[model samples]
Target: MSRPIMSKATALKISRAQFDINKIRFFDFLNYKFRFLFFCWFDLPCYFISKGQYNFAARVACTELSSYAAMYFLARWNFKPTLFVFLLPFAILRLGLMIGNWGQHALVDDVDPDSDFRSSVTLIDVPSNRFYLNDGYHTSHHLNPLRHWRDHPHAFLTAKDRYSNEGALVFQIIDYLEITYRLSTKNYIYLARQLVLIGSQVGMSQEELAAMLRLKTRKFSEKEIAIELKK
Candidate 1:
């Protein structure tokens, strides 16, 4: 079967443009960038929908449903319907997995999409690296895409000095969700404290960073505020 082909350069260009456009809104950016779950659950389907590719979206939806049905049937064969309720938690778990990617890449410099170190966040602690199979060393993974997961730590360690010099955002204790919550709550000061200073390199100012982190308040004309208050 013949398949569509796109060059790496073309794909990167599209991806970068999409990231730039989506980063204008926090939730939109999260949806566009995070795809760390069962493949078609959210992002892939949403991407198709956004592009008006309804046939592709429907195929993805059907595939997900089929997978769930297969699991349900397999479980049902071994357990009672009441016991099948135990599987409910897996659905919630999937949602959590979907959110995981957002936290990993959230604070990285999307402005320089071409540079892996600048575009990805790295988690330094042991627990995250072990649990995720060194997925926490994301910049390393991007730098060496075909390297074994077990080799990520070594690769990251070798380049640790360079990453630090480049102002890569490295979180020791916290995960992505915590960062997301803080940003969502308009805790800009805390976020600022955690940020690695890549603004100078990226041509992003502290004020611009602050604006990006501040989500709760929206600027409005006096007339608009009065109208909203009335409603």
Candidate 2:
């Protein structure tokens, strides 16, 4: 059977065209200057609002705020971490989640670059899944946002064959942060070494996997994106 395809990659590419948030400097910019106020007030709303975006907003506010908020109230809370708990959705956590999203959706097949199955990655046996409700199964989330988190492992196992066909990236002993870091540093050898091959991919050599990964991470030209969108 042929691999499954979805238009998410096209949407993701168009979204990424404006910003390369993978850089640590970009991160510094977001972290400094409370620039996120601008994101909250103007940038994001002017751009788009997905439920995931709102979920990210709420999740950051609820999670990080408590720890930071507690610290602030107890002592001389740095005006940065405490008073801005609510603003974390825009600042601290938004920047963080963008890194995760970049890692999750970084690899795109040159021929089928717009296909969700070809673009997103899944990390297995990663600790983040334990803490964040199976967030390692990002490809599954992209496949079906409504699917329960507990069911992701089962879903992935059952559909392993399809995932293999799509050449979907699967990793072990790593999380999105590591993936993002490795990609940013151009560490394809390590990434390929860590990649968990499935089905037809079982025989792929390390060099071949590294080459494929390099191709996956390359930015498609405007003409390429236009052609993919037209498809």
Candidate 3:
């Protein structure tokens, strides 16, 4: 059966929201900065590894791998033993996830660049004000996190859009891992752990640290969590 398309109304709503978010001071700049920086960072290394300058391919790998890492470490607190037990398996899994993501980059070439895209769900980013749901199962997981794999399509159908073939595979990996994490841990604590991990790695500045910690913002809010999910 053919997949349902995003209705014009839904698309317009999502697009407008995206535009609104894109116009946000912090998110607009932050999104572009990270997207470009990571695109260059990963793309260059991938070139050395792939022996060619397939920059677009590298960017997609970077996006997928980063998304997978976010989903993985954000969800599960489990640790795998390394040469140093204290070292934990998160690093190894993150590396493996990136390599796996690089392999999956091959599939991006299979997609039509002109393919229309829209997200059914919406996120209000108080940070950059950029609305995002490019890989949307993250949104689905947030909405009905208790739902399992085989049951997802039923839930997804309720949403106005679904991923194309290539997008589905990437989303599935992240979604499954996310679900597993939801089943194993409390969402807020998991989020806090993820915040600390990302904060430490990025050498978060005071402003960025305050933003992530919401120290200036007060109690954690779902709306805030939704914004973080998009990042």
Indicate which candidate wins on lDDT: 2
Local distance difference test, per candidate? 0.55, 0.67, 0.34
What's the C-alpha lDDT at position 103 in model 2?
73
Clashing pairs in 3: 21-129, 21-130, 27-128
Candidate 3, residues 185-226, lDDT tens digits: the string is: 323233233322221325645455334322211222345334
Cα deviation in Å at residue 116, candidate 3?
7.8
What TM-score, computed on C-alpha atoms, does each candidate reach? Answer: 0.54, 0.70, 0.21
Each candidate: how many clashes?
1, 0, 3
Q: Rank the candidates by lDDT, best first.
A: 2, 1, 3
Cα displacement (Å) at residue 160, model 3: 5.9
TM-score of 1: 0.54
How do all the candidates rank in terms of TM-score, highest first?
Answer: 2, 1, 3
Model 2 per-residue lDDT tens digits across residues 1-231: 111222474345533443343333554434433444333334333232332466545544555456555655744646565545544554567667666665776676777766667778888888988988898887887788778889889999999889988778899998998887898787888999898987666888998888888877666677777676565
Which portions of model 3 show Cα errors greater than 4 Å?
1-83, 88-90, 109-111, 114-155, 160-231
Stretch of 10 with least lDDT, candidate 3: 102-111
> RMSD of candidate 1 to the true fold?
10.4
Q: Higher lDDT: candidate 1 or 2?
A: 2
